[model samples]
Target: MKKTAFTFLSVIVVMTMFLAACGNSTKPSNEGKQGSTGNVNQEAPKETEQPKQEEVKLRVFSTFGGTDAAREAFAGALDAFQKANPHIKIENDVMSANDDGFRTKVNTDMTSGNEPDLLFYFIGADANEMINAGKVVALDELLDADQEWKNGFAPAALNFARHTDGKIYSIPMTGFYEGLFVNKALFEQHGVELPTDWEKLKTAVKTFSEKGIIPLSGPFDQSHYLIEHFVLAAAGAEGQNKGLVDGIEPNWEKGLAAMKELYELGAFPQDAATIDLSMAGNYYSEGLAAMILEGSWAIGGWKDETKANTTVLPFPAIPGGAGTGKDVVGGFGTGFYMSTATYENAQKKDATVLLLKHLTSQDTIKAIATANGGTPAAQGVEPDGLPQAALDGFKMVGEAVSISMPIDSKVTPETFNTIRANIQPILTGEKTPAEGLGAAREIELANKK
Candidate 1:
C-alpha cells in the first residue's frame, strides 16, 4: 500500500514539471512574433517618408504695368523664375510710370517702413531720400561678388547709375531717351514739314490745329515729357543739369515761356489740362494726334500703324535759348533697388538676390529692351525686332551732341513736383514763366536746407 502511494506522487510531480516547461516555451514564441511585427511597423514609415520644402514669398515693385511697353516681357520673366523655383513665390506689384501718384506711393511706402523687397526707381535725386534714410542697400559688393552678373552689365551703364556718393545702389536694366515721336503719315498728309527746328514745330502745330487734328498730344497736368523736352531745348544740357539748386536758371524760365508759346498755338490736346499721360498717349496712338513728346518706352504701346509710321527726333531749340538743338535727355536713369530690409532678412536675402540677378540678366534685359525700345544695359546684347522708330531713336542718340539725364534727376522730388504742379497754371497765363520756375526754385532751396 505505501509503495503504490509513492508511485502516484512521483507521476503527479513529473506531469506538473512537463506542463510548466511547455508554458514557458509558448510565452517566448508569442513574444518573438510581437517583436518582429513591431520592427516591421517601425521600418515601414521610414521607407516612405519625404522631407518637406518650406515655401518662400517675395514682393517686387516696379513701373512695369499699366500699358507700359515691357509689361508682357516683364510678366514672362517672372513666370520663368517661378517655374525654376517652385518653392518660391513672387508678388509683382506694379504701377504706371506716367502716374505722378506712383512716386508718392513709393516714397510713402519706403519712408513708412512698408518698403518692397525689390524696387524699380530712378537712380539720382528720386532715390536720394530713400538712400539717405538707409532704406536701400549698396549693391557694389554684391556685384563684385558675382562675377558673371557684374560682367553681364555694360560698364557705362553701371557707371551712369552710380549715386552721388560714387556707390551703385541700383542695377540698371535699360537706358532711356526722351524725344519728339512724330507720325510721318500725319505730317505728309497735312503737307507739313517735320519739326526739325522751332519754326517748323510752330508751323506743324498751326497746321494741325487748323485741320482739326491734335497737334502735339500731351497733358498739362502730367507734363513730364513736355517739361523735359522744353527745358532741355531751351536750357541745353549744361543749364538743365544745373537744376534749380543755385536758384532758377534764366533758361529754365525761357523753357516755360516756350511751352506757353506752344499753348497759345494750340500745340496740346484740347483736354490737356484734365488728361493724364496715358490719355495723351492714347490720342497719339489712335492717330488722333500728329506728334508726342515721349520716351522710347512709349513706342511699343502705340497703334501698329502709328508705330510703323513713326520717327523720333530731338526737340528743337527754342528761339534765343542756350540749346544747340541737338542736346538730348537720355542715359541710364532708372534701375532696380534692393531694400535694406530685404538684404538683412536671413530668410529672404538669398532668394531676393537671385531674383534680382535673373531680372537683370542679359537675356532678360534684351527681352525688355526689345519690347520697350529702351537701350539695353546688358553688354553685347542687342534687342531683336526693333521698330524703325526705335532704330531712329538709337541713331538720334548716337548723333546727339550731349546726352543729359532728365531735369528731375538733378533736383529734389519736392522741387520737381512743384514744377509739375505749376505746368497748367503757367500754360493758362495764371503764372508767369519766372513765377513758375521761381516756385520750383523755392521748393528746391527749402529741401536743400
Candidate 2:
C-alpha cells in the first residue's frame, strides 16, 4: 500500500509541472510587447499603420485683394478650404483691380514661365495669349467629367466664358455692369433734374459746377469707365463690337470728342488729371461730387448715406451718334483660369482642381457676389441685402436694350493702354480725338501682326 501511494504522488507532481509549462508558454512575453525603440505598448505592428497624406502647395493669383470689395469674402473662402484640406496649402497671391500694374504683372508672369497655379483675369483678349499658348487648361473636359459641378453654373455664364477656339478655359464667378451712378440727394439739393439725356446732363453739369460741386467724379488718367460709357453711348453695340480692327469707327471719334466737350464744361474734378479711379470713387462716396461713372463693384465701397441716395442710369447717348441710349457696358468679363502647369502635374492636379471648385462653388459665388454687388454666376442664387444702387443697377440691366462687354475686353492690353494714355492729353487739347484713335489703331494693327 505505501508503494502505490508514492507512485500516485509522482504522477500528480508531473501533471502539475506540465500544466504550469503550458500556461507560461501561452502568456505573452515582455520582449514581444516592446517596440523597436524599447518602448512598451500593446498596439499592433508598424506595418499595419495608416500612411500619412502627401502635402500639396498651390498658388492662386487674383484681383480679390488690396481693398477690393470682395477681398474679405475671398479670404474667408480660402480659410474654409484650408480647414477642409489640412494637407494642402494655398498661397493667396493678389493684386488690386484698380492697379494698372496688375495687368502688366499678370502678362509678365504668364510669359516668363512663372504662371500662378490659378489665375483670375479677363475672359476675352486679356486671356487670349495665354490660352493660345496653352499656358492655361481648357476646362471643357473637366466640366464634362464632373456633371454636378458643371450643372451648378448658369448656362449663360458658362457660355460667356467660352474661348474663341470653342473651348472653355475659365470659370466665371460673377458678372458686372457699368453705368452713371447719380446721387439723387445732391441733384435734389441743387434743383437739377436727373441726367437721363445729353441736354439734362449738360444742365446738371452747369448747375453743379456753378455751385462749386464737381459735376462728375472721374479721373482723367484712369478713365476706364468714362471711356467705356462714352464709347458705348456713341458707337452703340454694333460699332463698338467691330473694335478698331476694321479701322476707326466714326462713332468712336464722336465718343472721344464728347469727353472733351464734357471736360471744357467743368464736368470733371479740378484734380481729375492727377487722381486715380479710387480717389475719384472716394470723391463721390464722400458726397463731394454729385455723380460718378463706375461699375456694380464700386457700389459697396461708397458711404452708406451715398449708397442710400444712389441711383444708376444708362449713360446718355452722345448727340448725333449711333447709340440707342439704352445700351450699357457689362457682362461676364472676368473668370478663374487654371494653369496648364498645375493641371498637368499629377501630384498637384487634383488639389488645384479641388481648390478651383471650392472657389467657384455656388456658395462661394453667392458670397463674392454679395460682397461686390456683382451678378452671381450661379443660377438660382441672388445676392441678398444689396443697396438700392445695386438693385437699381440690376433693374437697369434687366430693362436695357443691349448689354455689351467693356471695350477693354475687345482690344489688346497694349492697344487699350494707348487709348487710356491719351485720355488726359485729349481732354486738355494736347491731342485731338482723331489723333488719339489713330494712335490706338496703329497699336491694334501691330498687335494683330
Candidate 3:
C-alpha cells in the first residue's frame, strides 16, 4: 500500500498510499458477525403502532483496527451512529491496517460471497480489481441523492477514488503526506545539523553512529517504499511515472544505488533487516534513533515527549537529482466501500447509506485527520488543534510540485512482491543495486501484461 494524479493522454492518474507493512498478521476474522448490538427496549407495540421494524444488522469490515491513529476516531463515529440509529445494529469486523494480508483476506471474502455490507478499503487501482469483479457498487446515485453531503468533499479527493467508469466507488477518509520525522533533540545532542541533502545525511550517520545511536530506523527488509520515495526525489514525479509501464528507468537504478550508498555508510539501524516497522518507530520515539522515514498518519504514534521535540521535513535532496525536495509519496489509499448487497436491499440500503454518510462526514473526517496528523480529504479543513509537526507536514504537502504514488500501487502484486523480496539483498550488500533492481524490473516487465 498507495495511485496517480497527473494525467497523460487517456490515462486518469490517481494517487494512493499504504500504512506501514508491519502489524499483527492474523487472518481476517471468519467468526461471521463482528459484535452483538446493545439491547434496545421497546414498549409493547400498541395496537395503534405497527410492530417495530425488525432490527437491521449492518455489517462493516474495516482495516482500521489495532493501534492505528484513526482507530479511536473510527470507533467514536460508529458509537455515535449506533446511538443515533438504535434500530440499525452495527457489527464491526476490524483488521489491522498494517497487515499485508488484510487485502487478500478481503478479496477471499468477496470471492466466497461473504462481502460485508460496507467495506473500509483502498481506492484507485487497488479497488479496480473488486470493481471489475462486480463486487463494488458505483456511488453516483448515492451522491446524487445527497448533493449537500457530496458538496462537502474536495472535488480532487472524490476524483482520487473514482474508477475508470467515471463513478465513485469509495469515499476517501483522509489524505496522507510522507517525509522524514526528525528528532530535533538528537540532532542537537549529537552536534550535527539536520539533513537537507545527501551529504548532510552522510555526516549525520557518521556522527550518530559514534554515539551508538541509530541514524535512521526503518524496515529495510520491506523497503520498497523507501526506494519509491528516493526515486521520486531523484527523478521527480514525471520521470518516475514515465518508465513504470515500460521498463525500469535509469533513475530507478540510480535511486537504488543511492539507498545502497547510504546503507554502506551504516545510515540505517544495525537490525534494519530484522526489525518490524513498529519497533523501528519505537526506536525513534525513545530517542535511540535520529530520524525515520514515515508518513503523516504515523505522527500520533510518537509519544508526547518525542512529539515535543519532533519536526517534519521533506526527504533530503539527492545530488544532481531533479527533485526540489517538494515532491511527496502520498494521497488517498484507505476509504469506505458500500457493497451491492447493501445498496440493492431496500431494507438495509437506507440505514447503510446513512451510516456511510456519518462515517465520512466532515466532522468525522476532521476527527480522523486531526488524530492521525493527516490531511483531510474534504476541502476547507482548517489545521486547528493539530500538532505543530503535523501542521508542518501539511505545509510540505501543500507546496509539493507533484505527489508520487506508492510503487506497490503502480505495479502488479507479483511485481511488488518481487521488489520487496529482492531489494533487501542490496541493502545487505549481497547484491548490487543494478542486479537487485534488474531482477525486479524483469518481473515487472514480464508480468506487466
In terms of TM-score, the best-performing candidate is 2
Backbone atom clashes (below 3 Å) for every candidate: 0, 0, 9
For each candidate, what is the lDDT?
0.84, 0.84, 0.73
Q: Report the lDDT tens digits of candidate 1 across residue range 148-227.
A: 67876766678778888999999999888889999999999889999999999999999999999999999987878888
TM-score, candidate 3, is: 0.87
TM-score of 1: 0.88
Q: Which scores higher on TM-score, 1 or 2?
A: 2
**Candidate 1: residue 266 Cα off by (Å):** 1.4
Clashing residue pairs, backbone N/CA/C < 3 A, model 3: 1-18, 2-16, 2-17, 3-14, 3-15, 3-16, 4-13, 4-14, 4-15
- Which RMSD values do the candidates have, in order? 26.4, 22.8, 7.9
TM-score of 2: 0.89
Kindly report which residue stretches of model 2 are placed more than 4 angstroms away from their true locations once superposed.
1-49
- CA lDDT, candidate 1, residue 175: 83
* Candidate 3 displacement at residue 376 in angstroms: 1.4
